[model samples]
Target: MSVRVLLVDDNPVVRIGLRSLLELDDRMDVCGEASSGQEAVAVASRERPDVVLLDVRMPGSGGLDVLPALTQLSRVLMLTYSDEPAVVSEALRGGATGYLVHGAFQSDELAMAIIDTAEGRPRLSPAAASVLLQGFHGGGTAVAEAPATHDRAEPTVVPEVVKQHALSRREVEICRLLVAGMSNGDIARRLFIEEKTVKNHLNRIFAKLGAANRAEAIATCLGTRRGA
Candidate 1:
């Protein structure tokens, strides 16, 4: 199916340019446009596009302001020029499907981003991720900056599976770790199992849970809890 897209940006030129660029791909179509965060939310609610490319900074309501409201309408892909990792993290925490660098992306890259976000993954621009890594793990040492404002790619969604049956105890453990962003290697290490064995167990867990990925699996488990 063609990916229906909504363009949300204050700049008329940028919006028109983006619409023109994305239209080149036969799989993409601009179903709507909004000049502000609030308008974007309204248009999104009505259009119910497959993906939304939103600018981070806008008057009255910024990307953060309208993000949650758009959640019910469509997957949101942050297409902005902002380089702040804190902003990125907050957007993810607030339910953004993906993040991309508007200055650096090509039409094809944006198309791929739409596909990725539609599937439910968090994609960050490489440069943006590097900034985040530096801020989180590089200590006080500053990393070399990229000379140019380059385009970046981010995921729209991470594939998750559903639980079709009751989960086993071990499956619950895995689900918990997965929700916490623990990698398979980490989960295996904690469980005293080989990583390959963990993969096998996860396979069964997905099938039994009817989930496409760890997030869905975890959400299923959480739904059965007292306050989930």
Candidate 2:
């Protein structure tokens, strides 16, 4: 079945543009549209879309405000113009599957974000990823546009994943690199594994952590590891 999508943006023009772009992929079908956060929730409840393209600047109930609720029903990839660190951190905390700054994405990037979210692999634009790392780690910014390719630095020690989760040694290593803000390609090259292998490991990692995507995985790891 095509991945059903619900488009939520205050502007009709933006929603139409997204629909046109998403429909280009035969695997995606634009199932509904909503002009506000409340409307988006209502339509999403009725349509039960697999993914939701949600705009952050909606007039009445803001996107972040509805994010915790919307995420319960469908994968939500935030579409916003803001790149502020606080906003990025809050959206992820609010259960956004991915965050993409508007106008930064080409059609392919946007489609990949939606598809990845539906596949339970969170997609973060380089910029979005950079900011989140900064917010969480107080680390320097990530090169947001680093060619989707990039790295093992010093062996950052990761606490053992909860034994009940049954994470392997290599999975724990990969999770540490992910916390270091490495991309799939980066992680694969560093570990001398194929990119597809990195993705497969990530899928298993998410399952073990009870996470829906990379953002959730990162949050879960951070929440648990910080106190360790």
Candidate 3:
């Protein structure tokens, strides 16, 4: 089936270009377009597109501002020209489904991104990956549980709930950021990844944590922290 999509950006030219580029792919369909956050929300609600290609900055609602509004509408791919970590992190925290940079990908890459976005994989600009890698490990050695020094033996078993979907190192990193209240954009900035990549990481985290939303994920991790 063709993947349905919506374009949300203030720039008519950008929207037109994206529409043309995306329409060339037989597997993708441009169902609608909205020039502002409010318009995007309204149109998305009505059309219920499978994904939204969103701009990072808009007139009244920046990428961060329109996030909550689009939560129920569709998966969002934030497109921006800036690679600033701060901006990336904010979008991620606000719950963007993916992040992309304008002019970062060619037609094929963009097509692949549309496919991946449907599968819940995040697509980021190549440079964003390097940024995220730096952010992931730069935060000092993850505080591991210390071995029992006295008579008591430390539990070696992974928690029953979380054990079902063992979190990878990347998931762990994303979890730390979520618990820290960093937006996906911010996490992307800190990690030097695109905000979209952060979203992908977060999808893994949600599965591992058995969480439906960020708040639940945070609470689950924090609950464990209290015991640790």
lDDT of 2 at 206: 88
Name the regions of candidate 1 deviating beyond 4 angstroms: 131-228
The lDDT per prediction is 0.70, 0.75, 0.68
Q: Model 3: C-alpha RMSD to truth?
A: 16.6
Worst 10 residues of 1 by lDDT: 148-157
Task: Estimate TM-scores for all models.
Answer: 0.56, 0.59, 0.58
lDDT of 1: 0.70
Model 2, 64-170: lDDT tens per residue?
Answer: 77888898899888887765454666677667878888777787877777888887777777777876665432111233332221223533433545465777889
What's the lDDT for residue 41 in model 2? 94
Count of steric clashes across candidates, in order: 19, 0, 19
The CA-based lDDT of model 2 is what? 0.75
lDDT: which candidate is best?
Answer: 2
Between the candidate structures 2 and 3, which one is better when assessed by TM-score? Answer: 2
Q: What lDDT score goes with residue 153 in model 1?
A: 22
Q: In lDDT terms, how accurate is model 3?
A: 0.68
TM-score of 1: 0.56
Give me candidate 2's TM-score against the actual structure.
0.59
User: Which portions of model 2 miss their true places by more than 4 Å?
Assistant: 135-228
